[model samples]
Target: MGGGGTLFTYINKSTSHLIIPFEIAFKYEEKGFKTADAFIAAYTEWVGADVLVTENRHFLACHLDLPFKVLTAGKCLNLI
Candidate 1:
């Protein structure tokens, strides 16, 4: 399996992860992040995750003071 396959498997296995509250995601949206991006970011913070793995450049480029680190999937895999 390749990176994409590994990532897909990892995500599928994380289906048991907790869902973030709407209020938390809404707060991120108010900070100017897109809907999905806001939700992802909110969940990462709410879970106290060490890092956020995503390819969304806009989310990564944001200058917001996020508690968790945002990284590309490749970077995340390297760390793992």
Candidate 2:
């Protein structure tokens, strides 16, 4: 299989996939998050995730209230 197909298979088999509701995403948007960030945040909250990893400096610096922790990829790796 090609790399993309292989990656898709791995994700399909190994990940706990979910669909985030529009209301939840919209709530984040109202809280000042951009469209993509809103969905990401909504998914994190909906899933009850412990941490949300990202390299975006703005997201890292934001003081928004959220249930989960946010960390850089390096910081997440270090915790492993």
The parts of candidate 2 lying over 4 Å away from their true place are 1-17
Query: What lDDT score is found at residue 62 in candidate 2?
Result: 93
What are the per-model numbers of colliding residue pairs?
0, 0
Candidate 1 lDDT over 1-80, as tens digits, reads 56654332233336447667899999888888889888888877776676777899987788458887778989887865
What are the lDDT scores of the predictions, listed in order? 0.75, 0.75
For candidate 2, write residues 24-76 as lDDT tens digits.
99998998889998888887777666678888776799945788788898987
Worst window of 10 by summed lDDT in candidate 2? 6-15
Q: Estimate each model's TM-score.
A: 0.68, 0.73
Backbone clash pairs in model 1 (N, Cα, C under 3 Å; residues 3+ apart or in different chains), count: 0
Those runs of model 1 whose alpha carbons end farther than 4 Å from true positions after fitting are 1-17
Best by TM-score: 2
Candidate 2, lDDT over the whole model: 0.75
